[model samples]
Target: MGFDQYHEPPNELPDEVRTFARMILSLIEEAQAIDWYEQRMAVEKDKEAKAIMRNAQKEEFKHFGMDLEFLLRRKPQWREILQGILFQDGDIVEHGEEAEEAVD
Candidate 1:
């Protein structure tokens, strides 16, 4: 829902970890925008809207992929830690736990 819902308790993570989580959340926000644009393009037959959605979707994918790769390559441990924190209680947790174990 809101940013606060995504955040873990402050005591659970260091400043750096918190910052990285925020960065990932920002990427998610951008991704959501891309999705919104795509949906709008699908519903509307406007030429300009379609073009804008296409460009935005491509850019969003590029940015999202780059950010994910950066997290996986640069700070892998932190990435794993962040995943655990983000997904611990969600429906994704079971699948995520498998992925987390593989990373470990």
Candidate 2:
């Protein structure tokens, strides 16, 4: 019954680190749920079922966002890097490169 999220011994890790690991795991789960719903909706023949899947997928998206935001709020540098890349209209790769450079 050991948790796979912690790379190190859980007892040795601080509470904040443990919480961070939990949030990271939660984020991963939410992303997986979103992907699962996407695949399900793609293959689903019933329109109503597809619509319900879409709705559920949207909820997963929200949860993913919340989890990401929680982690980012704790990591200022990460948030700074993301700020330069997210919601920008320019080239994504270029933005990422610039963001990395700016942070360095």
lDDT (10s digit) by residue, model 1, range 1-104: 34573456766778778777877886787788778877887897888878977888888888887777666676778677566656366567675666677677
Error of 2 at 47 (Å): 0.5
Query: lDDT score of model 1?
Result: 0.73
Quote each prediction's TM-score.
0.59, 0.96
Model 2 bad stretches (over 4 Å): none
Residue ranges of candidate 1 with Cα displaced over 4 Å: 1-12, 74-104
Clashing pairs in 1: none
In candidate 1, clashing pairs total 0
Candidate 2 lDDT score at position 100: 91
The predictions' CA RMSDs to the true structure, in order, are: 7.5, 0.9
The deviation in Å at residue 80 for candidate 2 is 0.5
